[model samples]
Target: MRRPNIVWISTHDINPDLGCYAGVWPGAEYARTPNLDALARRGVRFDNAFAAAPICAPARSAIITGCFPTSIGTMHMRSKAVPPPDVRLLPEIMRAAGYYCTNNWFTDFQVDLPEIVFDDCSPEAHWRNRPTAETPFFAMFHGMATHESQLYLDDDAFAAATAHVAEADRHLPADAPLPPYYPDDEVFRTAWARYSDLITEMDHWVGGLVAELEEDGVLENTIVVFWSDHGKGMPRAKRWPNEAGLREPLIVSWPDRLPTGAGVTDLVHTMDLAPTMLALAGLEVPEAMQGVALFGGEGALRPQPNEFTFGGRDRQGEADDRSRTVRDPRFRYIRNYFPDKPAMIHTEYPDRLPTWAAFRRLASDECQQRARGELPSAMTAAQRAVVAQSKPSEELYDILADPHETVNLAAEPAHLDDLERLRAALDSWILEYGDLGAIPESDLEERWRPGGRRPATEPPEVALEAGVLSLRATTPGTLLGWTPDEPASAAEPSSFQSEIGLPAPDGRSWNLYTGPVAVGQPIWVKAWRIGFAPSDDIPVRVPVPV
Candidate 1:
């Protein structure tokens, strides 16, 4: 059977605000995303897909590894200094199955993958570059036009990018609706309008890629997947555990394999994509994968529809916050580990926006007034309450009743039973996954960075026994590589490079070397951890038969 080609197109910081999502907010209709809408019409649109982590690096890590970021100690944004070698990425597994993999130069893996994972991983990478036309391919194209940083661009930069957007489409309604938490002011309205225009630009890129597939005559045999990393780039949405932060737009199109124009209301997590792709390719999903394949043939590990999905948040940039949440179909429960911290903590990135700047100005003025023994006068009492309020330990919201999640029902006696049930579910999940977020960031840094320096990998031990080479490392998850020792003068440039062999069998240390070698030939072996310093090379000369 011929394996279907897979093309994953991912965007940054976008939620389901497209026209097809039926967003009722003012100016939502101006979100010109006809390409995505058409794709939804010709494919399966997932109504309840979520990111396991709210931030970029952590969320992308979960998607690539089929495990929660917290489980792998990568929950902190941009904190994956070194990869845990034991964790095998999805691309590596696909490559092992004879699939030619390529990524269009955007990787926030948060963990180091074996070099063998992608045949090409650069701006020029494409499936067409594959040596054989018959080779099944897996390609990922990342679209950054809609990224949150685009919102903060200076006037000139914004103009250069949005010049193509028609003037009428660029302006939002005067009374544009915003989340309750945001101040309904001109700055926010303009921001939302600009964001909508960026999404339209992203849609254009998506259309171009699909058109290319059609032109190549590969559309019929390809499975195309489109999704965003997390939620909208607004203040409350990006880093918070609310629906806006976790919910994502997911559409899958595979001609003749799945029903078109169908909407699946089943709750799904981003990590599930790894297992789903493997299962669709008729390969075995790894036992360590925490996600379940939602669509595959019989014998696939399909999760129960509408099962509760989970999300988590950790350190984002300079702000240190820890929160976890569990969401079923209608109800959402959140637990803030550090309840004493205010929601408006000082973060450099968000502070760039006028909305955040206004809050900070009010907060600063309030601090000065307190210093003078006077009550705050800069902000209204309600606004001051929101700015100064520390988060509650527990929050419960009926999403069906309060889609904005503005009202908290945790204190209500009528919802005690529901709150307890969801709280218990969150606790069980944390324990089952061995959540690393339970450990403080300072403590983790000490362990992961001993002596105040990045960790160093331990060298793998090499031995020759029974005419076969054996390699082992004491550190768990250390990846091993080896090459035949060659002199500088006689060796080609590529000869100095070592190939990463199969991972340790126990995920700790043990990889049997399988290569043709004559007795007395010397080999050099080394160890590496994705974000850390590599181990020193060890040379071992093969022994002659006695």
Candidate 2:
């Protein structure tokens, strides 16, 4: 069978609030995710898909590496991590297999990745841009309409993002359903409405992309995977280790190899996605990858669906609280390392959002009112618990009965067995993987950088013999990337470097070097080690046959 083209579309900070998923959530009625719903109907919807972390960078790092962020020392948000030797990126591996890989704009992998990882990685990137129509391509599209920044963006910015959605389709604040943790107020309601509207806008974006696939007459030959990096961008949901923070919508549709309108309740971690894609492409899932392939892997590489999914939280922006969580099919258990710290870590980034600001106001009002022995306050105790001074050391919640996770049942005898099971599981997983979050960030930085400076990969040495080029880098675990086309001019080299250094169009004819290449002309080779700056390209001229 010919390898199928893979198109992975991801939305930002979104949960299972689509029109599908049984339409049970508060904003589901207003969330007109027609495109996503249709995709779900034609694909297998993973009802229990979760991310390795609640935040974007950590979760995305795990997704790309197929290893938990904690295991790779990337658990902290916005922190750089040096991947272990022998580990390679999914796109790099795919490129080696003659696949045209492209990422549409976003690549916050939390590591210093080389430019040659993708053929194109800009907003203009598309699978159609591949050199040949017969080449199988892997394209990643990021839908940012539902991003957290959209919730607090200026009116003009928000207007432009959701301009495609009709005014009639926009949700009303009054009709927005309120979560149990949020106070009853207009600000929170308006936040919900805006989020729902953005989801609709994202749905429209997904529709357009799918339509393009159909127009190209490759929809049947392509595998469409739609998912979110994490969950809702609300205060409690976005960064917390609870269900709303970890669980997200996952839809995989491949008309040729998969069943239709099926719901898979198996526990799937975002880290598994990398290995799964590799397996689907008829490639070997590397032993370095910790995740199991969901679809295809022979004998020793076959996937074993998890009985429980694990997640972690640490150092989001300004906060330093550490926590870990494990979720079975029905229950979630959270272990807070710093029970003295509040669940709401008063970070400036989240405080800028209107919803979080409203939450702070309500909490403040309730505090003052309670001090004076006031009869009633705007925030209920359940709502105030999030903004409370301290958190419980351990929390267990029966998510089926209480999706909001407001009530903690860790101490309850009725749920002792379930709690213990998950606790032991979390402990075993952490011990096996070695939680990097346990180490202080300062110590880790010192170890990684040594002297507070980012490491740079040594340039690769290129040799040409008998019209064949051989490349090697002195640095351990360095990846070499070469292009048969050299720069047109000296000035072009810097421009090419800039393109690779930043998230710009990488249209250069770069190829991942797996072995010696038979080149009859000059070639440009560069070296890069993960978590280190890439080396400058060196040109090597191959002898031409006379």
Candidate 3:
């Protein structure tokens, strides 16, 4: 039997709010996620899937590498740098295993992906573009309609923005229940309604992709997976380390090789997806990957049923905060590295929301009244907690009892044992991963930036012999490529770019150059180590005949 092709559809910031998850507020039917609902009924739904990090770039980096972002020095929100040279991405592994891979234009990869990793990586990237019909493929489609920015639209603007949505989907019922942290007002309700509409829109995109698979007659042979990058995109959700930030919806369907309609309640992290994909493709999971495969052949790594899943938070955009969390099924423990920093880390994106504006006004009003020696009675304890600058270093929550994470059980005597246990687990995880949060953010920046003082990759040695050019690097697995040194105004053709691999079958690290070139032509060659910066370009002139 042929290997199954894999299709991963990922969305932005949506938690398990789908109708199939059975956790949607007001009514499950209101979610209008018929496509995903049907997928859940036809596939395996993971009840306890979580992200290694709550924010986008870090979470995505963890998923793609099968390693904790902290371990790979990609814990920051927008590091805009590639992982260190030692780390290998899932696509690279899959490509090496003879699978065609494509990322549909959304790689918020904190780490850089080499050009060799994917056959295509544009908005139009798809499995259909593979070189041949017999080739197995892995493709990822990222949808952004349900992103947090969708909720930033005010009531009047939301109506205009979502005017394309059916009127029935445009508004939520007046009695819709909201999270206790949010005020029970129209602004909050309207925002929720708009968010729901965005989900519905995202669902439509999912349906379209599924239809395309069926139309291509490859649906049955394709393993379809759907998931979100992280938790919801609200104030206390996206950047926080609570359940609201870490939990994600995950569904996997493979009609030919696996059972359908199965529900997995195992605690699995998003990092597991990479190794799982590798296992599914009959490839060995690299030892450097920290996550287990969850499913595959007997050699696949699987975590225990009650094993704790870990999460971390670090500098997000311009805001700097550090926190780490470890959770089992019943409880979650959080340790804030910067206890003096406020729970609210200001970023320009969320500040645009009307709800966030109102929150800031209320907090400002309460502060002004306090400065005047008057106790503020209008703000609820929950509201004050949202903007409080100082927080306890440790927080323990009985997630089963306090799903919203409003009450801290860290100081409660009744849960002291549980707190200690989780605290130890978190500490062990941090040490095991070599949590990058231990380093100051400014220092990390200096170490990771393009010209920063990080580890250096020695440039390839270029030598011309017997009318041919040879390139070799001391760095094992360095990827070498070259282009002609043409005039600045000249357009370089695609043929000018070529990858040079190892020359001899027994040789360890040498690219026996292949060239029979015209005289007087100049060429520039460069080498790249996955986790380190590309080496300086070396210009070599095609020698004139003696």
Candidate with maximal lDDT? 2
Candidate 3 structure quality by residue, lDDT tens digits, 143-185 = 8788888777656876565555677665464745467777667
- Candidate 3's C-alpha runs over 4 A off are 23-29, 154-164, 171-175, 298-306, 368-375, 448-473, 480-526, 536-546
Per-residue error for 365 in candidate 3, Å, reads 3.3
TM-score to true structure, per model: 0.83, 0.93, 0.85
Per-residue lDDT of model 2, residues 92-167, tens digit only: 8888888899998777778755777888877788999999999999999988899988977778988898998899
Sorted on lDDT, best first, the list reads 2, 1, 3
C-alpha lDDT values of all predictions: 0.76, 0.84, 0.75
Worst 10 residues of 2 by lDDT: 496-505
Count clashing pairs, candidate 2: 0
Worst 10 residues of 3 by lDDT: 498-507
Candidates 2 and 3 compared: the better one by TM-score is 2
* lDDT per residue as tens, model 1, 55-135: 788899889889888887888887644445556688777876778888886777664444435667657779889769899
Q: Which residue ranges in model 2 land beyond 4 Å of their true spot?
A: 23-27, 154-156, 297-304, 484-508, 544-546
